[model samples]
Target: MARDADATKVRILAAATDEFAAHGFAGGRVERIAARAQSNVRMIYAYYGGKSGLFDATVAEALRRMAENVPPRPQDLAGWAGDVFDHHQRYPEVLRLSMWAQLERPEAGAEPREIYEDKALAVATVAARPLSPIDVLVFIYAIAQAWQLSPGGLTGLEEDPAGGDGVAARRQSVVVAVERMVHAQP
Candidate 1:
């Protein structure tokens, strides 16, 4: 069989995403990730250099996928908020990995500032009112990702927090909150 380096790399990143999402950088195990990817630890280190490099690659892949699936809707920031909520809900691993990065790599810093700068600039150019551009983008993101950060991942308002009407209601709440913030006069 022809060796497929790209496919191996993809599998490694996918495995790392799930591992880090569930257990975070500190608790995530390289052996588990290797088993999940069907790739040896040596290959992982060769491709990513070390556990830290693997974690960075995993985070970058998650964010890249998110950006592709949920392109910014700066003009309709309210709708954008709803999209973010939906995106995170569908691919929760992305959100979990991000939280893990924040907790584990506080000094990573900027988080690829160009992406954020573009997003904030898009919002700022379109909506030049209320809060600053960066504020609007991040607040919407926080509202979208808040459920993941909630203790026990339950906001106390839902009996079955991750399903049915509860999720819909929470999503609506996120959209509404962002709408209010986007519309609030300075």
Candidate 2:
């Protein structure tokens, strides 16, 4: 019974991720998420309280998945940044969800604190020189996600009009930038 309940929750979260990514918090429809998850509205409320709760849960789950799958490797910041870029490309929904959270729900609860602490420690230990771990992490994340979030704004000005390999080029640019940032003196 517990297994079945967990499955139902997972289904609901997956549906909510797609719904929120497409429509955001204000525009997202709980009824649609229920339909997509094959679960009723009451069940959503029972599990997640309401639309806000569901959104929070969806974002939390997305972050958890990313951390588990693409944890930062401070010793290899460039490789880690490349992996992050790939993950963002593959799971663009996560980035969309984050954007919505920032724009629409700035007051939302912070990301898991322990994750931040662990990442900071890892980065501090392997840093080439003294640097704020938080700053390094933020820099790497921004470089990796900037293109995905705003390709036209970020890469359009300088990129060739007919560049067929934009993604590859941007990814390499991100890795190089991360390497430089990690190694540069504060």
TM-score, model 2 to reference: 0.89
Q: 107 in model 2: Cα distance from truth in Å? A: 1.7
**True-structure Cα RMSD, model 2:** 2.5
lDDT tens digits by residue: candidate 1, 1-186? 887999999999999988999999999998999999999999999999989989988888888778778878877888888898889878989888888888998676514566677787778778467678877777888888887678873486668775788888888899889878877877
| lDDT tens digits, residue span 2-24, model 2 | 44778889999999999999999
Among these predicted structures, which one has the highest lDDT? 2
Local error of candidate 2 at residue 5 (angstroms) = 1.3
Off by over 4 Å in 1: none
lDDT of 1: 0.84
Cα error, residue 125 of model 2, in Å, equals 1.0
Clashing pairs in 1: none
Q: What is the lDDT for 97 in model 2?
A: 90
